[model samples]
Target: MEAQHTPDEKIVKIEKTILRGTRPRSIGYNARKGTHGPCITDVVVRLHTDSGAWGIGPANISQEKAKGLLGSKINEIFKLPFGAFGEGIKLDLPLWDLTARILNLPLYRLLGARGKRDVQLYDASIYIDDLNLNDRQAVSLFKEEVYSGIEHGYHNFKIKVGRGSRWMEPKEGIRRDALVVRTVRETSPAGSKIMIDANMGGTLNSTLELIRLCAEYDLYWFEEPFAEDKLLNLALKSHLIDSDSKLLIADGEFHPPNYFFELVEEGLVDVVQHDFSDYGITWWRSTAAKLESWDALCAPHTWGSYIERYHHAHFAASIPNYALLEASPGKMPGIIEDGWEMKNSRLHVPNTPGAGITIEKKIFDQGLDDRSAFSLSI
Candidate 1:
């Protein structure tokens, strides 16, 4: 793939689409914040070049003014300070897509990843926050959710623990934590994998208790058992826990790529779960390579519509020690008319040019007409 661009290759137009009609779906409680809220809105970014070729990507940045990007070379635009641009480095995805398309190559080809690879995908439901339920009722609800995931061919499953909500007191919270893990262990297929995400809600002592109680179930990994900001405590607790029981630790979903490196160097986690949308495709390519050097696994944290999932699959196809791709069971309808396929519990890579996304413009237009779509004007 060509890395250098000609002088005439200038970005002419930049359009940002904010999608918000996705009905609020209550996901598992986020232990780090101690609550869950409305479903996340998505930002679709389109980078149009002078060549009349355009590339689209999902980003966390907002671009309300298109003229700001007018008549500048794509590489020059990416070099501007992200804060002033209303976007992060993630904007590079569209630029990269546009560049790859202009060069007539797939995005993965530019990233040095081969054709599609089978990515082991896990359904991230089974949250333990049924406020209507007592301990028994909560366990029952978790079992139902896990069973549904299993029937859908997911070989691995993740459940929220730490009971971060006030609905369960401290003692009761600890008790229910054990119950939920036990229930998942009993209900899942014998060789299947189970992961627990504490969302950084647990105190070191309480989290230790919870881990010991449920350690016999052969958990694939324990995720963010403590708050992310407490790096010292996280490292101390993770080391103690790993020494006691062989449970692999996973975290770093909320941190930037640089800080995530701290977690790896300090031995705070066994697996790193960073989001490509937050950092960008180039960051992930380099970060995944760095993690491999540290002998760690990369499980890119993903949540959003089908388009975002497609992006994850494309990048995941490159990582050698990719742990598992996260698939949130919650998704808005009709966001993506057609794209990649999820079969036998694996997210197969897409071979389409550019980002391989097919947005249902009509559905998005309906969202706009109904005022359900959010417009992130700069």
Candidate 2:
């Protein structure tokens, strides 16, 4: 994204751009394969705007799933405007996430966020392989797999558990659940913070009990430990705790742009997780604007094509209410692996442009459909 305009503040003009492709198709488990898993077959392009003196913005796509309505419409997308700079960063994932980032760098700079030194960030792992990985070994197993992340400078952690109900009960699931936390805490730096995700894995009784057990571990927060539509259950569960555990996250499956509203307006979540693969960046940006004053830390959910994750880096780097960016187990491929290196416990922001990586023509040719339907704008 580039720009030119306005004398009042700064002048920069931005034009819409498109980056399209057939995304990667991967179907496997904790080392196995499933009957039929979702595959993302398109690329997400973010937007950027500049003031006469600088450039800024967020993503236009959050999570990029090959199975969704947006995925099928990969031929195009647009950005949120910036009549006002540094305003309305989102807490949920959406397409505008891309546009906002390019714009964010400059706005945040003006707002006193000088990038990494000004703020330290760590990526949280959203989903986990529960089928192959046993609940009993959840934490220890998590540690074993993410050791590289620890080594790579990630300290904040998140675990996914909706895959099964083993973690839903206090008497039955708490043992294994506790073990997961114990093992992670034991193996991680003493100061390392932890987040657990239940993905609505329990009954009201079970969720409440599990929450208490989680409280004992000095956890950073718990995510979606109850069912999505269980409003009453969530209400009853809400009354069970007296302490402010920092947050109760909800990564409700594909709630889209309404995800944040449902979670926040209902007083259900303290932290919200949205991905480029799911909501597209437009929704993420609008939600950010709505959520900015609420004091909620929006962590963008991620797991898909390299560019999506690459796009999220700037997303996390740009927003104010931004809490964490989802970091995959691998060193993120492409330029992140080749150009910059992690410093401390966070990803080093790239000084390069548009993801800082050159796409292999073949990857696009082999991964995407060549028809006009797959063509994008810029």
Candidate 3:
């Protein structure tokens, strides 16, 4: 008979990690009307495990901070959780306060994810939201992102739409979006899934119209068709979409937790998003439990570092109702895919014990340091 490994025997220590990173120049690609911007900057965190495994996490800073200000306070100063940074900061910060002491980036991520072992991540394609761009340019941008995603061996893609898309336009916002959808769908290999997001930009009339329009495409899910506060509108949408056939997803981001809770109880939400940036890992984990009980699937709103992805992955993987994790690149292109990639859509969770991702020393050197962070027990 095989021997069972006891929990006490395998359990290890926990520690906190703070990661500092920078994207000196921001690059933006909007597919709608072919508009790209140069204003993206990022802060990354990683947790390290006692056994040396690592997970990756990223945090979002406003565009205002990283704009054209080289050698700015962005990296030269390290603000504590409740330090000089005023009320705008996430006051009860747990992880960042701990990991900042260490020099290793990936080492930090492994630890933050509660040492979950490994995380297989999904690729979230870049955004090109300029609807003003010509169709040809839109198609080209779609193909470009698709190419990049395919190169990374990813089979899923997301398209951003719906600012005034809810408006009843002569051009038909849903129809226009359909063109973008069809274009992207054509570029992928068979069996690939496509999702569309409105970014909370439409109205009641427009949302219903787009939802119906999306139905034609057979999408994997439709996210935030109405603004976060449109409870009545969401209720109406719930009435519109029969949950079993397709998903009417409401992300627990930008929107409040109460809204998600109510929606889940009513069986109105098929899929809901859980964001760590807004709630940290603890709150999101609890939210995951609630959603799981209701038989609702979850996808994390992963907008920051790869470490954030690791945190999301743990919740996404542990839940049986986990749909697809929120996918995107927290670092520059090709950083995680080359040496750190997983095979056949399955990424090896950080095996080094903690977060499992490793950052190249040269790249770490290039990262901006807003002072330095102190470490702690996770």
Candidate 4:
């Protein structure tokens, strides 16, 4: 008969590596940041146990901080349901991955699997590509990108706005913003969902004006038109109601103050988008529970890393009030992922154990030579 192993596994070693990859195309500017560039980098950590079990995830913990956790038991760092606490919080993703693997369950199943395995996703790569092009050229580029996303299995898109806030004249920026929205709406197939984000770069007046121009286009939501201000959000909500527009207001990705939840409670914010990696799975579970009562939904911002997108997919599969996930739409070299599938705009989470991803040791080693990496042991 096979013997059962207890949960008291001791951490024996930690391997930290760097992954560098590229987007499908060069990401242009947003309301605030400059060219996003084509390449991306992520710091990943792999945890090994004395019993030969191991798990890995994207994390940026320092050697000093990680060295202190070398000999700790797995149970001391992470627990089911509530996740990592105390110093273990820094190792949230790796710990969750390790625990789920130890139990031989998929991460979503480990989180209770209250939601569907397939979760809806929106293309988040639409940036301000019209900066140097003429009106016709800009619209053409936008159309091409949208079609490419469609070809890649996306039915919804999140278009970046607020060009007037940084790149162009205020009025022209708004006009161009409306033009892009209209072009995307008209070009995409019927029933396609469109959401706009200003990255907190617009004023109330500009937002309302853009809304008025695209009222008939049927937008899914308007995100971060401006920084988090209760009065501004209230006014925006009131305007959305008075205008009879179904556009939801989405924010909170920048780690807003505590009052943001109060806004959700008051029904002012329609969707909450705390970052998937920044907030971790435990926070998403707990926050989703709180938002359930407030009648708000979570999308959990996932813009940069494709690995983080998988993390969001598992979390989305485990929550009921999740609205939609932000899709990065790119590839990470040396990362081998299995089971998860994308059809149309929804991501079907893999039933496989431990996030369903592994690193190719040969490719990983080759890539790590030119990038930043480290290791620690007990």
Most accurate candidate by lDDT? 4
Task: Pick the winner on TM-score between candidates 3 and 4.
Answer: 4
Q: lDDT for every model?
A: 0.66, 0.45, 0.49, 0.86
Q: What tens-digit string does per-residue lDDT give for candidate 1 at 52-119?
A: 88777775443433444556666565531121123325466676667666766555655667434777
Candidate 2 regions off by >4 Å?
Answer: 1-142, 162-170, 229-237, 256-263, 331-340, 361-378
lDDT per residue as tens, model 2, 1-378: 344222222112222123333212222331112322333333422222232222212233222221122221111223234322212222123223322334443222222232342234443443434434566556555566457457666676665433336423335445555556666666666676677766555556556665665665667766666656547435643664445454455554345344446657656666677665455444555566666766566776665443555445554555667665655444222222324445556666565543334434444343334332232222
| Candidate 4 deviation (Cα RMSD) | 2.6
Ordered from best to worst TM-score, the candidate numbers read: 4, 1, 3, 2
Ranking by lDDT: 4, 1, 3, 2
Error of 3 at 284 (Å): 2.5
Error of 3 at 100 (Å): 17
> Candidate 3's residue-wise lDDT over 270-363, tens digit each?
6777565665544555566677688876676765454455445544434455666655533453234323445544454432322334456545
lDDT of 4 by residue, 1-378 (tens): 122233679999988888878878999999998889787777778899998999888787887888899999987877766888888888888888888899898888887788888888888899998899999998899999988889888989999999999899999999999999998998887898899999999999999999998898899999999988889889989988887878999999886877888888988898999877777887778889989888889988878877777777888888788888888567788888888788989889998998888889986676456435767787
lDDT of 4: 0.86
Better of 1 and 2 by TM-score: 1
Clashes (candidate 2): 67
**Predicted structure with the largest TM-score when compared to the true one:** 4
Candidate 3's C-alpha runs over 4 A off are 1-122, 129-132, 163-172, 229-244, 329-340, 360-368, 371-378
